[model samples]
Target: MANVLEPYLYLQEQHGFGQNKKSSAPGEEGSDGKRDGEESSDEDNQAPKEENDDNEDEDGKSGSSSSDDDSEDPELAKLLRENSESPSSSDNDEQPRSQPADTERKGKGRFIHQEYDSPAGNISILMIACWTMRFPVMYMDFVRLIEAYELPYLDSLRLLPPSLTLHLTKQNIQALSPHFAPTPMHMHRLTSRLAKLMFRSYNILTPECNAAPLLWRAVRGLQGNPTLYTLTKQLAHTLSLTLTIHYSLAPKLKKLKTRDPEHHKYDNAPPEVSLAATVIVVLKLVYGLDGRKRTPKDIHDPACALPNLSEYLIAIKELEERERKSKTSILSASSTSSALDMDNDMLDDYLDFCEKALLPRENRNIEHGVIRDYFPLTRHSSTPDEGVRSEVFEDSLPDAMSAVRIHENSSDLGPGNAYAIYHTQDVLGSLPEDYEKIVNRAATWAGVEEDYVCGVVERFERRLAGWWDKVRREKAETLGRVDDEVCRICIGQLIQHD
Candidate 1:
């Protein structure tokens, strides 16, 4: 199987995953078509060393003599004179720092920031398998199902690469006029086995699987697409409802006070449905899809931006209703076949959980809501009215005008206002005023200890910080040689602050 997959994997490798193209090699001709060798001059070569020497001298002078010290003191006078006479002494004490090897070699190699591309490439493989095996059905029929069900096709496809699109189309076309078509029974059996295999291989049912990247791509692709944005919000809401069920039922699974003889009847573990639903919700929320709005189009219009989305939503609502009805019937029915009973019981439990969870807390007479209430909506509202704003371009106000505007806006600001918006202090300060309260509330809603919630939040913050640091480092390393302003913005100020 590995050997069979090697060719497909190699093909994916050639495209360098889903990343933007690797930047041009260092020491090569730049965007202006000037070679690095040609761009260098005697003045340019001498300037950095000269600047470093001046900086070192200034540092030595400042460190050796402070204005607060008595200039007439014998020890202070001696130290100042020695520092003035031997600037090299101070330079030597400040160890000769070497530039990072990674900084120098960053864009020189073929694999610049390769990790960013890995997720898309990896998920594409799973998507390809689904496409080739027709586990759910042919791509066309799947699209038709989307149309019938009213799912967002373009938004989903935007998350996938063009390669997958081509493959799906080709495979579907071939299947339509194939040499022969399989009988319905054979097709069903094949699809069932393939679907099972794919799920197992991808570990879709397991909590250990890292589906974050795939979810990220899906959410990222929602930019500029209002139809997809609306669909994602609906999906997110559905996921939230599913999570509510899991939290509500978790405590009821075990009752310490119950001594009834019929207690054993309720001892069975909760269905995996809640866990599955939670995973879906977490992935979507983590990847920045959480909001609400009305559907953008009428359901029946053939030319609607998102054709069948209304029908798909309606179908989902109907299914939920049917599931609710079935749960009531199944709970009351007294069938004793264990296999049949277990399957029906699991489905019924899951449906009941979702139905109960979706209702408002006040309406349902619940004292607590879900964990979602603690967090802000991950999705941002679109800025449709405003055109693009430029910082230092022709479209921007002149520097003098900009400075005046800033002065006017920040007239009452303190020294802290000087910090950049992305600075650590500013970022951390932006958190909710009652951070512990929110954490505790969420923990109570999720039926977990506050400490566990705090731990998760800390870990997530650490990971986010690390991610941002890596991005900043990469951006700094790739700073252009020709642009001093760019260098100052990307590297100089960042390094000085650090």
Candidate 2:
């Protein structure tokens, strides 16, 4: 129990819910923040942490957080009450006794948040995947395969000792590539869309994120997924924001004071009761999507885990006690709006939070993205995901950019590195007998000389082992999207709306 609950234990039990709490240790920054709100509520249903060994084993198999259990310790009880109450009694007290029959007439039906939008790169890849991939392909199966295969394969190089990983030759690595990475046919249909989406969500969020958290940090500084946290503050897309509620916002909820009065005829139900009734409402009503359950393995996967996991969990609740306590959930009860917009105050906070981006000549991406500017003509792209790096060095255009180059010649329209990349992708699957066909087909498309294409193809073929080794080393510099692991769960919600 101590080991499991140690991190969440208040840094100084000496201080309770008041202002004097010294922000806990620097390492415990997110303890007060909401990481996964539903997950915290889920804890209430589990058997106690101090149960017998068999109970612990059952809980382990089911995958629940250990610390969410009730504690008899006076300090712990005070802290959980301070941090984990579903909806404060005061929020319940504020509810009206009954809803007017006319309240349903005020419903805002099926909004797309003319204000916030998805990163174009993210939209582009799913479009490509939708358009190109064979129909009847099992999405859930692909998700399962990725979880079972690709992730482990990627980590094998780093986790395995040299003795084993050394023999983890290129042939073995390339063998998995064809089965996992998007196929050549699939990738080409989009013309570097995934590459672009990569830059937008991943690159834009890291290093110098001038658009989002810049506004979020300056303004609300609320607890939510770092992506959605910054996003809810900066932009307010329905799908991303909804997912953020479960993964980040819901867990931080100590108590709520408000609930959506739209779908079920306004009510004064407790926040916990409301959430139990509407995990579906969180991500469901927006897209008719019934998202798959998020599991512990997925949450803990490095790709999905918060960048600063320990500190974010420790520090979040402290940062947003009042925000979380507002209990003014954007929870959608209506089939009409995504529920986020129902509460105009929260929505206003979202739209207005990103106002500083409007200064003239400030290289604005998301700031200008705000619908408030009313300058549709000035905004270049919906989201700031610079696709495809030109060569990974200079001439850095962050349009999801990296290693993607196109020939300027009008006549040739050379494929440049794209051909090489496609060739590499093909080489992963093609046998020697089929190499020429793959090479010639690629040459024809790019309008490049056959021999040049063949040579590029051959170079990759000879050093497939070395190539994968280089990939392993380079990815250390920056892997693809952290959301890549859990995307399948939400892809349906996002793509249909996009």
Candidate 3:
């Protein structure tokens, strides 16, 4: 046994492990020119030396340096010594010691450290894997793989990382091509997954998130392909439904006060509406229907040959109409009539009481239109002179004409004559004492009460003004767009005579 251990000891000595037992500066030579321990002079002895006993064996193994020695192999020990003395190792050596072993192990199971790669690289790998296996990969699984790789959600998934995009495009073309004869279910799964992933990148509030370019490319590449057309239409349909739901819920949301003190804002429309609107606009632009020259003839032209263009147009029109009606309904509720005819009659009676009891004779002659003219149309105006006259004219003209026509047509007095007759009474009631006497004399000559004449005129004036304003607003919003070429086309179509 001793003979066998002698060879092991010789091997360790040859590898420089034997030199570790003596105290001497590294590479220092003794006076006799041999590397070995030697007593130093007073100046060299001033430097402290580590207290390590080579004679004490803790592990019951002879020739062991120390129980705390990090390296057991002679070569490893030399390398570690060299590394510790290097300049680069100084930073690492100065770092704080690691946490206690128990502390580090406590929460180690909760998290995992994963390596990340660019979205393109990961997607390419996934595509290759799926193609090699010739099996349909679940969308959720694909999403999971993306998440596992910690890839960013790229909006340009359909056109990015040339290799992956080319593969996807090739697969799509083959699936849609008649020559390929691919399995329908397999094709459906693959395309559906791709669509879902592409759509996922679309965020309504993020202005940069746009899927239109990719979609347009797909349409152009697969032009005249029924499968592609159906897919595109389905996407548009989904967006339409989303827009409808948002519009429907907008009015019902509670009004929120914004930072502006004068204006009360509401969180009515969702962010999804912006996304849906953008997509619709992009689709229109893609088909060339968004141009100023768009017309019924252009829309119906067979030469255009854009698949689902008509359906998209119709869907967009319907959405716009629905949105318009919803907005109009809300405006009508707050700014216009909300009561039935019966309620109006009751309100009229109340106004009559106020006119007779509270209004002085001098103040009665002040016309409603004249009073309205002195007020600004909106709160931002500093002067009432801006729109007063126009508003007064808009309010009073049409009702006056209708009242006069009714008076000329009616042979007998009845509820049908109430508007004309009451208006005359109101006017007479408001007249000054001097005008009253003149009006009374004229009424007596005409064989009618002065009050009756005044009331009929007043009622007729009020009705005419209200109706005129309504018609003006409607015309401004509809037929008034003569400067816009698109509007001109639409109007020309409606008014065109055969």
Candidate 4:
């Protein structure tokens, strides 16, 4: 339920906008219209040094912050104690790490400002109450599962925060200026890449594995992937750009004349469903291999069951054109007046702010280091007595990895080879010693070089994958047709399960 009228302004008797700011506003410069109080430094312009919360581990996942001194803030101290006691906070390096408290820190004398937040991320949680529980429920002891394959770092800076592009505010409208605009390339690269990967990697994340992707994908993209749902919703973002450069938004998508069928039932279909159908059209119109080309057959493809998408695509195209014309008319009217410069200036700022908030990479030049995407996976130095785990890249991971297990009774491969098979559970091959020290220790106990042991592990890994595949299928069948809302909560609990 969206508010028809947002940013409710205060009455004259109430706390007017900026009333909390000391004395008068900035524009009230000495009768002459100059910036007031500039000679005296205003603390508002000076950004306070905010402490970054991301403390990354060797596996590149955000770990507990080492800033554990309790005496500074009693409130924080109490929080730390509580978190330490929480079951979800894990000691295992590979398990889900404890999230730091989300306290908004401020410097001394800093004014209290309402930090911007979005509900799109929490929408899945909201639907929990509405669910009938008809969908299959997943069952897994997450604590054990994560301890086995620290999955928290699987996507890194791979999902965008919901945009405020459509929810423009009075202050944001002023951001239309060129000075406030963001780099076109920055906006496209960060938003596009993160969204696609978040969707395309569906079912690829592995067994009892991560709940993040499923939670995000479900109830997204009109009962499909989110690539289109989000993209279409933000189509208004193109209006934020300069008219001269708007061509860059979707240069490859040529305007095509699509005909409306007279008796099509899709014309009366749900707005969201119709909008989703149009995404494939735009994908096909794009001149590159980026989105590939989507077609009517795609809806009926075994991979996708969107039976009605073929008809609804027409509705989406009409909706897109209507929105464009309506928004463009509003802007054109503004451009004809004295407010033209101001409107353009505000759009620039809006784009810049929106980009910084949504992008997971290079945010504020990564100064606060809030996002933990590129933190290097730590490698350990090993002594002869304690064997070393092999060096591995966190980014490049194989599709199938062997799970670590030492079958004492089975003679399939010697204990050493079996131990090696067990360690390859994750794509990066179980993360290094935190990938598991027992693995390194076991190999040493087997009295062989890890290189030789690894050779044996590789030979049996393919055969072991078949066993893992069957396990995943049985689990999926047992928990048939999972409800999207349930997946989010389950994963949410798993994340908290330490």
lDDT leaderboard ranking: 3, 1, 2, 4
TM-score, candidate number 4 = 0.16
**Candidate 1: tens digits of C-alpha lDDT, residues 109-222:** 535434223222333344335544433222222323232222322224433455766767754444322232222223323333434455657743211112233223233221
Q: Is candidate 1 or candidate 2 better by TM-score?
A: 1
Give the per-residue Cα lDDT of candidate 1 at 80: 68
Compute the lDDT of residue 110 as modeled in candidate 1. 31
Worst 10 residues of 3 by lDDT: 397-406
TM-score of each: 0.18, 0.14, 0.16, 0.16
Q: Global lDDT of each model? A: 0.33, 0.31, 0.34, 0.29
CA RMSD of each candidate after superposition: 40.2, 39.0, 30.9, 37.2
- In TM-score terms, which candidate is top? 1
What digit string (tens of lDDT, one per residue) describes model 2 on residues 370-470? Answer: 46456343333423233223222222111121111222333421111112222434445543322343333333223234455444333322333343345
Q: Which stretches of candidate 1 lie over 4 Å from their true place?
A: 1-408, 411-433, 480-498
For candidate 3, lDDT tens digit of each residue in 246-326? Answer: 122222323345543331121111122222222322233233332212222333322133334444334334433332333
What tens-digit string does per-residue lDDT give for candidate 4 at 52-156? 222211223333334633325788667867766745444554242332222223422132221111111222222221122322111111212222222221122
**Model 4: how large is the Cα RMSD against the reference?**
37.2
Q: How far is 424's C-alpha from truth in model 1 (Å)?
A: 18
Q: How far in Å is the alpha carbon of 287 misplaced in model 1?
A: 20
